[model samples]
Target: MLPTATGRIERLTLPETDQTVCGRIALVFPRTPVAAAENPPAQDLVRVGEVRRICGAQLRNWGLERFDDSVRLLLSELVTNAIQHGSGSQVGVRLSHTPVEVRIEVRSGPVNTLTARDPGLLDEDGRGLLLVDALADAWGVDDAGWVWCVIATAAHGA
Candidate 1:
């Protein structure tokens, strides 16, 4: 009835035939590498594009194309922030789906602070988390230094 991480199968028995059928329900999660902060800026840009493409494809596979624009924008902002502020060498991106929503996570090196702030009108920097707050149903940084956001599935009124 419930899916487990260890990939367990459930069996159902039919009384009339005295037969049993076994089946497993599994959720497939896709992880894509967005970029390496150590890489050249141009290369990082290319990696960001690849991450966007992969996310689009994954969302389409789930029949959630309507969320593509929001996903793309939020993911891009997260990746950019990781590349710019994170301390580690590489940025990793992951997309997972549940009954209610789709979650996107970006992991990089440690961050000095997780707080989001408003930027002055003429300022060219900052505002990444602002966009995320406005678009994502929920967003936050985990203890392991991964930044994650959830977007409601189309069926859930996203």
Candidate 2:
């Protein structure tokens, strides 16, 4: 069975040059603002797992199950970061893949600072980006506050 999206999924229109790509799925998550509260409720965290399931299903549907584990982990980290730290009310996750690589992009409100830090061994957090850096072939934050990563699948012989 296919996983369901917590928000909504839309099919994106790629350029002519991207027609060879197997598939693409875009998910939009709207941050549920609390009434006179400063932070989102704990329930919001559920979206993280939902997104992972959606990502895995999409990969399987594309005949790219080999990437399900890494892709889902990467998607989880990025989506978690966006939900926890982003100031924007909406978060967007875009997944697209070519014959050799899969691209994941997470976008939210404008952030003046975006960086990965080395945390102490005892620290429980701050390792999200580190995981992304280690697993992704390439990753960066765009001027528009979009955090994007590319995981090359050539090593998988796909």
Q: Which candidate is the best by TM-score?
A: 2
CA deviation > 4 Å runs, candidate 1:
1-40
Worst 10 residues of 1 by lDDT: 21-30
Q: What is the C-alpha lDDT of each candidate?
A: 0.65, 0.79
Off by over 4 Å in 2: 1-17, 33-40
Model 1 TM-score on a 0 to 1 scale: 0.71
lDDT of 1 by residue, 1-158 (tens): 12223321122222332122111112211222344434445555565666777778768877778889998898789877766666555565666666677788776666545777889999986798999999998988777777889887756674
At residue 133, candidate 2 shows an lDDT of 92
**Model 1 residue 9 distance off true place after TM-score fit, in angstroms:** 32
- Candidate 2's residue-wise lDDT over 1-158, tens digit each? 11235554433444545676767777776665444335556666787888889889989898889889999999999988887777777777888888889999887677655689999999988999999999999999877778999889877798
- Give the TM-score of each candidate: 0.71, 0.83
